[model samples]
Target: MGSAAADALLPLDASRFAAESCAVVDFLEVYYRDIESYPVWPDAEPGHLRTLLPDMPPEDGESVDVILEDVRRHIIPGLTHWQSPNFFAYYPMNASTAGFAGQMLSTGLNVLPFMWAASPAATELEGVVVDWMARLVGLPECFLFSGGGGGVLHGSTCEAVVCTLAAARDRALSNLGHEAILRLVVYASDQSHYTFQKGARIVGIPPSNFRVIPTLAGSAYGLTADSVHEAVKADVADGLVPLYLCTTVGTTGLGAVDPVRDLGEVARQYGMWLHIDAAYAGSALICPEFKDYIDGAELADSVSMNPHKWFLTNMNCCCLWVVSPALLTSALSSNPEYLNNVGGEGAAEVVNYKDWQIALSHPFRAMKLWLVLRRYGVAGMRAYIRRHVDMAKWFETMLEADERFEVVVPRRFSLVTFRLRPRHEGRDDMEALNRKLLVAINGSGRAFMTHFVVDNKFVIRMVVGAAMTEMRHVQDAWELVQDKAKEVQATP
Candidate 1:
């Protein structure tokens, strides 16, 4: 009976298995080929995916046929399809065929790059790629290993901020006992990403010690040097030690850029470690026009940006560079006798990336980035970035042309923050009306957009960076917004 059962299972031979694999590939090919043309939002309701999946797992091992069937039936419909050209909502999480193929190859290899000895090639490749990126972005040589500083890839800007904060904290506490430092303060503009505050909290800085420097309206929404100086002076007067100042190149809510050169001077005056969070707009630095935003960035102790955000790479590729590796290593370095290896014998030597961030295990994510840079040369990347910037400018022009819509913030990078005017003069309910308009627009399912509340005013944000998005797509998106607003206004 056992022999018969084994024989029965073996009936589906290698040829049949190969045919099934081909079928899956063909299905994916067709799916992806038309993905760009798909609607940004599905017509289906929320519970659609949950209803299709089984409530519980199977007790026995299932055949490939069953697994594939569920994948086709349940999983495909639930996806939001970020790659679609119609996706003009949040900053585009772009991906390319080269990047996907590189990730696939890396997944197949499945190498653990925990230590230099574990995967030498993976480690070296990461180092080379980061250096290449730093050079491409016009980062100072001081931020590269060749100039005594080095970089490591983290999963997000949050992780980067936390790691840099930890390093700054450790450096501040080195002279005095950690307990002696009662009030360690950090400074950031009100426009800075909330992650900066989250990072400060995780690093043990009290809420009272987090200084939110106010940003003036119509003043570029960046953290001013004078505000930082005053905050640090007040903290010092209160016997608090100023430790970190996070300056953003492109704030999340609006693409507001902080004054790096001026902020660097203030940080130096206060003996604070300065970090530049350029998670969204840093990729544009590849284009020379945007490089000035980060001028005097050499003075920054550390800087971080997300390649996954706008560099045509897949998700979770944040590049962090530090002016001093010693600080980072001192903060997070660990050594155990069991884990000791011959490769770590020397003093000035190979790097163990585990000391860089909050995690021990990391995927071979560098492969995708390497593939992106190689496949799309620096010139190609610049061209792509310029195209989006130009589109954003065009959108700004259209918004300015409309008397009903007012651009709340100046166009910075590729994000345009604007909102509709009041329906009638002195109408106190304009914010509500605008909010309703945004809801109707997003709910239409033809296009997706998001809103940001700045200075207590509701403003819709039009972010244009979907990898395959063209001029026509932008035009269609604007048309949808206008039509949706009209529809909302026409309703009771």
Candidate 2:
């Protein structure tokens, strides 16, 4: 440890990093400002990007200017602009500058905070922010850390479903014996997201054990208690246990909300676990007015929402709350001695987030949560959500008033499902006709929408909540839709 040797410190040259970062920042600013000019969806067929780019990675490093230019020239054309105001297809993947800032900062830090001891500030702040969100959604105390329940942020609603379903699976198996796993059933409405069935597959639930109950337009496409009860009763009569019931607060295709209290009673009847998956519409619950959609959440063993989808957070953040953390921790915790914290079991209340999900490693997701909450405040979030819902209703009204069109299910949350009505009594090709109308509407380039089949009706879905969406965009979309519908009708 000679003074001379120690005095020779490492050189700190960061000019390249500074230049590249500045270039990226400038490009982002310009891209966001001029995004509306870009087509919301690409017209390119498959293999466009692959055919245009090099066959393999280059041996030499590319210049920053060259890379940035390539991004603008090649990457830009191939991408769908989800952030565009006129992009109303599927659901809004709303993101804000504040959330982007959090993402950038988190990536720079690049620390793995998978446990309290790994990065205490990140872990604790995650808990605090998640609790803040729980309150925002009007969740019961049982879903909070203070009431023996806690939250963890997963990358997607799919991951949340898988983790919670896995927890319920293990718990039910423990009590009923693992052999009975083949006979245990899971229940969800036909309109629910397809992720539940995917989860069932991942968790090894038998295909025969799933009950995808039919939902009708009369019930607004939601699963009813009676349907669930009859399914459970039939299974019980055959000596099968009803293991889990997933009631949605805003289903994917229809935005239909199941009767949570009624379904909860059905779950309770057979001692089954009730989990709520509100990936798309759960963010609306931040507004007190929308809280009725989740009236019986207290009876739920778990609940999840995608902040990335509607809460103005970017991709890769779904907050899942479990009433009893032990269920998941006990099922998924596989921390070896090497991965253990210094203080072991004595450190009781500390959360090792690694035990909560399938993956042991995760990004600093809480940063986005903290920043979004701080920047907008709950009031701003509520207004954002309400505005989208209002716009959806406006579009629904426009459809209902027109003689050529019909509102399919009334706007549920920020999604309006409607279609062009059949022109004649004997002509029942509305599905094919509406399909052409969708293509024309999207081809116009001013707006984009999606569709789904419910009760054999071809319903177009116009979902609001793009970052810059407003009344003008909604009205323009409606007008274009009406014009295109007429052209579609006149075609054949």
Candidate 3:
């Protein structure tokens, strides 16, 4: 414990490891205990942390205690406390203590299960956990391991979209050959998450090959079956091949739910692959009441949802289900001499997930899903989903009571998008006013939320998913918004 030379800390022994880990654990306990008191967003501009810390890593190892001190001093201020009770921005990115423990366990094991022979337990656990997830959500057996298709955990929906698109592309190319790759087209609603566009680009699909079909705002910004049918018709008339159709269960900006059942029929009729992206609202489906929203998705070729977005799991974990595992593996699998293995090939029926996704080495993400599911049983999980939807409905009622604000979109799950309509005359600058109000609300540091432009109107999006968020916090946020809007309007 004395002030020894930096070299003394070079190699951490077991005692030193325990000391550092214990110190950090103590720090985390205090940090989460006081999370509500912290600012949701930092006042410091960019480069604040870089300016405060040393320009380079220490030439010699430093004591973990010293690093901890620097972290508390410099890192804490720069953090935007997404875990705060008032963080009603974007989707409900909720994380629980169990999720943290699961992540720590995964980090400890650090197994590379690229092949079943590499680690049988790791591969099997993922398959089992994914199957459990599918069953708990009432997904069809076609997407389960017992069926030919199955699910895998990805870092995000972007990765899932890209992987599934690759599979669909390869399937199309098998029949149409490489020249048709340019003619191959993917379709999504305008309100769809930008991830689909990003995925299409990553999969080498031409920009012109991707179609951005506009959704009707009057119908809650949902992509209609008629609109898609027409788009496909036009594409076919021009000799363009329709490759894939992406239907979203929950859109990002407005939380729109495209008509999946109707769209699926069109995709089926056209022989195009159907992929459903439920990154945000998928967690709601766990509750039986919300099962109706995804009724048509069972027939789709692929589907994905993110527990990290709303299901009390940590960040960066997405669960993807495909109706055809053979198609996915065939497109992605590369049998290099170095990776040759017979464990899963002959009699063993082991599934090496490396061939199912872009990455060969996947983290044990199933631990978080397993841990959270165990901590909150099926009943508890359903109750959690119901609480958020109920909270969202409550917020919507509050907005409706107020005459100045208009709910731009229908309440879907926990996301509520509303925009301000001026009660006073001669104030056509509503968009500018809402922007100013949003700036003031965020600047207050009492709470933090985000805004979006829907149907050419700026709207505030409030998502209630922080595990600690309560009714009182929601009420307080509205009061703050009303005050902020008044301040903006009163200004010259």
- RMSD each, Å: 3.0, 3.9, 2.2
Please report, in order, the local distance difference test score of every candidate based on alpha carbons: 0.84, 0.87, 0.86
Candidate 2 ranges beyond 4 A from true positions? 1-14, 343-345
TM-score of each: 0.93, 0.96, 0.96
Candidate 2, 1-492: lDDT as tens digits: 356644753233367667777899899889989987987877889888888789887655566789999999999978888998999999889889988888877777777778877887888788888899999999999999988899998999888888888999999988788888898899998988889999998998998899899988789888999999998999999998888899999888888999999999888878999999888889999888889999999989999999999998988799999999999988888868887657534666788888888898877899988899999998899899998888888888888889888888867699988888877856758889889999998887778889999888888989998988889989989889988987887786
Candidate 1 residue pairs in backbone clash: none
Residue range with the least summed lDDT across 10 consecutive positions in model 2 = 4-13
For residues 1-492, what per-residue lDDT tens digits would candidate 3 score against the true structure? 345764465454778767777898899889889887888878988887877877788766676789989988899888888888889988777788888888877877777777788888887888988888888777888999898778899899988999999999999999998888889999998998888888888888999888999988777888998999999999999999999999988899888888889999999999999998889888888888888888887769999999998888897789999999989999899888888765556644678888989988888888888899898888988888888788889989989998888888879788888877765757558888788888899999988989988778889999988888888888898899889877887876
Candidate ordering by lDDT (highest first):
2, 3, 1
CA lDDT, candidate 1, residue 51? 78
Give the distance in Å from residue 94's predicted Cα in candidate 1 to where it truly belongs.
Answer: 1.3
Residue pairs of candidate 3 with colliding backbone atoms:
none
lDDT of 2: 0.87
